[model samples]
Target chain A: MFKRSVFVAAYLALSAGAAHAEFSGGVIKIGVLTDLSGTYSDISGQGSVIATQMAVEDFGAAKKGMKVEIISADHQNKGDVASSIARQWYDRDGVDAIVDLVTSSTALAVNQVAKEKNKVALVSGAASSDLTGKDCTPNTIHWAYDTWMLANGTGSAIVKTGGKTWYFITADYAFGHALERDTTAAVEKAGGKVLGSVRHPFPSSDFSSFLLQAQASKAQIIGLANAGADTTNAIKQGAEFGITRGGQNFAGLLVFITDVHALGLNTAQGLIVTTSFYWDLNDQTRAWSKRFFEKHKRMPTMVQAGVYSSVLHYLKAVEKLKADQDGAKVIAQMKAMPTDDPLFGKGRVRQDGRKIHPAYLVEVKKPAESKAPWDYYKIRTTIPADQAFRPEKEGGCPLVK
Target chain B: MNAIFGIPTQALFGQLLIGLINGSFYALLSLGLAVIFGLLNIINFAHGALYMMGAFGAYFLLTKFGIGYWWALLISPLAVGLIGVAIERLMLARLYKLDPLYGLLLTFGLALIIQGLFHNEYGSSGMSYPVPQALQGAKDVGFMFLPIYRGWVIAVSLVVCFGVWFLIEKTKLGSYLRAATENPGLVQAFGVNVPRMITLTYGFGVALAALAGVMAAPIYQVNPLMGADLIIVVFAVVVIGGMGSIMGSIVTGFGLGVIEGLTKVFYPQASNTAIFIIMVIVLMFRPAGLFGQR
Candidate 1:
């Protein structure tokens, strides 16, 4: 009788995934809301749209007798613009899912909008960990990397390697705060100490003054808890100020591939970074990245790779349920299934709406070591999928049982 | 082992030097705005866009044509200055007879268009232009590690700024230009082609901006939005110095850069706003600006 009961439960779970439902409007519309022309454009702009298209084509939705349409727009990295677009897409355009919000402000704003409207938000680009922590919602799945994961992977490594003291030059914003807090935790946990930190206005071009303060603190590691231009500027000026040459190093808490590319291997060499994906990771990634390169002319950043993976996974879930009627239902189903895509393989979404994937710590290659265009990093180590992100129960998400 | 306002004295000196380096950029940019506003009697909002073009111009010359930094210093300005000349002739000249607001609007629109086009091409992360081979390192000068390139920047900006100030305030041509601004009809009666003089002055002002951009390429990322970022601060410097006052713009530019640098030490959060706060104070006390004549 017990054996029969086990068999019955297994049969029911399979049937649930096989459950057939109608496709709303006879089609599934996905909106690729991204930073198209702003600072993050290079990292996650038109490239995201192309990634989504590649996913749709690779999924062969047409051959499967399902209609999947992709639409994209520039968020301009503004919260108001992103939420307004989110409302219009959900209400009027019938976009069942929005993906690749490039900046944290836009992502947080769109997350709320997605929750209210009961649509799926697969956050692929934004770095803040709050989306899956305090701000986790049933309708959103943080599909890419986040601040906590980055600090855990890159921060601990630096500390273990004798970077015992830290001083942070942070951007004065929520994203920066989260990055700084998360990094501080990781640094301390790994037996390092944080001496002091200073916050500069966001998007600040000159970092000399703030950098001097960090320098004066006599910290072994100057942690830059900022992203995009702010990080690059600080690093560049720190070089001019002899920060690195004077026996201190800068830990760029949120460095991206495009940043290394922008700084060039000459300056970015030896800088450690944590990322969820690298195009050259394996045969599968290389093959997919090659196709992406052919289309976009640039290799995929982790965010772009995540967009392809998340969009592919979202489609698979939609196709399984055969409906876009309820975004929360689809997101729940996405969580129920394990993710296996070429870019980020064999991952799973947690109950807290955080996607679980192993993140890699990579060091930027020197100029002489680079073989071709856009070839930037060499992997150092992998933080396992389970340990890569904040532990599910510790996230404080109401959704986590 | 010295301290001031709870900050170390050595670090404060480092910040002041850094501020002076950044201030050189403001002084150069504001000097151009001052000249254009004083002599041309037209506001050139395209100045920032022209500055971006200057950086891109340097980036392209080196990558595409095998040109080097010294040549870029000469070529980038000449090329951007010509574009400025064309803008003055084709668009700005017509608006000169109208409200200065028209000139401001036209150039502001042009800035948007140019910045957008460059952004589309560059993708906004920006391209790297290496520091010239000779200017690649820093020297420890007791108080701070000053990058030789920054020192070069200070010297170059100072020479060019004082050169322009002299040209405007003392030279015979500068007198004719100032006279034209006062009474163009009388200047035209004196056989001086006021329109052409106005065009050249605009070009010169723009070239000064391009010169600053070239100097900045080594220090900052050659990004599309670099000018857009600094333009507002430079404008504040001009306003605080009394818009259209050349010496005033020059002095206030360096002064505010130092003030902002001090703020960075005492209260780091207020550094970006320090210049504007000074502007607010100056405007309140003297509505015509610190040096603007009533």
Candidate 2:
């Protein structure tokens, strides 16, 4: 009787082990790499982590018998630092995929590491169009908006509206140069003249000298090709100098909702910019953003929203495979599937790893127009997915052919 | 349209004026650094953090107590000075006998803690402090339009710089302070209360930075990291001016600011590097700094 019982127990254990193997090979870990203490922290730091957690919980990865774990680290917006972290995460920590890289330089660095290590990266925070253009990789997906899309959306819109003569106060860096180049193309294409440009040091507090140069150009619009505190300071000091009242407009090429909030309506009003997502855009966005706000105490910027959408879609691809999938294969599966999330709505990933979604042009409302807290942006029009970004053939991506 | 060296006159003058305004800040900040380093024999790396606190103090005074900018001009520095006294008495006083690098490192750590606290509470984005009604609008000089508040900043900082210069260089108290800087033990033998003088001198030096901060609150975005970067540039200014001489810091501060402004017009690429480049040149010519005494 004892011999029969022992054989029965061994048989049951073997069957259970086979069942687990069929469901998933082992635990899958995703790393959230972003700027935590530096300039981009407000938009992508802790908020992106929270958004990813929400997606993990909602996706029910564990119920499918695949244990998924999340980890995060601060990239500090440096390329070397980001590369080191990516290398360790991929080589040692078994971080299968990384998400939410903020600065473009860092994102580009991590993208190379991901490709070299055979891990996937979902870039939600970085805005350089080069990620999909010349630096395109099968291991990375450029989620959220990019510089080309922003320039095409806001630059052309402003130029078409007769604010034609332009001067650029560009931050002296890769992201700023790309933005200025793309926006200049957009303006010229719309029959606008490029007056001039001044490249200021990054994170400069005094925009007086730069603004003075912009003023001297006497352009109808001063294009700010910078982000974070640099843009906010330019707008604030522009108001102090009465740049707008003197008959010139300020076109913020890359403005976030948090930036608008920081500048407040009095300074930021009448400024027009482009974005991929806004919290109060529709019922679905509002519902998702409201749930996010309940936990984060602020509305979700598009980057934070993108984290949710991409992570959910990534998990879906993993589940469909029913085992730990390779990075390139997982990305291919994700590209094959359509992305539908409450925050961003339904979108598609292209061959060059650009996500297709309708981008919105928004105007900052006057103080009197804001009805409630975080009621900042008033949507003017939507650039349909096909028209939002540059055409595939023009981007020069190797994968496009 | 009149142009100078192929650059428009308005742009040139406008940038020069801006350079002068920036020079005013550099002058005040470096002057304080020179004064503290002379007597204390330690670099107060927390000077920038203290400047940031001064701006926050003024901001709180306005938002919390309905105190206006004019009153803040008086109260903010006093408050920041008191905090500096406490810091000197409790923390900095212990490091007086150690290597000066320890003092610098300790203060640097303190700077990070202070900046982190502000970043946690208020965030990295700037909070605008409104210009006082009495000092709004601009007076157009034919070359360029200069805002009245900017002009006020230039005039007031210059006056304060000169006033501090007079206090340190021309007064009886100044002589004693100078004597103590030479030999505190000898000054103590003369019944000069050397320790008390060190504490007050530190407080007064810190007050100069706070005054600049309160003055700056109206113009620049009052943010946490504002002082962090500016302090680095000011240190470069001190090195160029030679931290030994009061007037060297004052002159170098203003001179560098104007040079930076000029660079912005003729060559926009070198504006940020102009000051540092000049510092490198000056150090090669005069290892003790232009005004620094050996």
Q: In DockQ, how does model 1 score against the reference complex?
A: 0.66
Give stretches of model 2 more than 4 Å off. A1-25, A323-325
C-alpha positional error of residue B167 in candidate 2 after TM-score superposition, expressed in Å: 0.3
Tens digits of lDDT, candidate 2, B1-294: 788899877678888999999999999899899999977887988999999988988999999999999999999999999999998999999988899999899888898899889977776666778889999887788777788998998899889888888988999999999999889899999999999999998898888899889988887778888889799999999999997588999999999999988887777767778889988998999988999887
Clashing pairs in 1: none
Predicted candidate 1, C-alpha RMSD: 7.1
Q: State candidate 1's TM-score.
A: 0.95
Give per-model TM-scores.
Answer: 0.95, 0.94
Error of 2 at A52 (Å): 2.1
lDDT by residue for model 2 over A38-67, one digit each (tens)? 777778887888888888877866565567
Each candidate: chain B TM-score = 0.98, 0.97
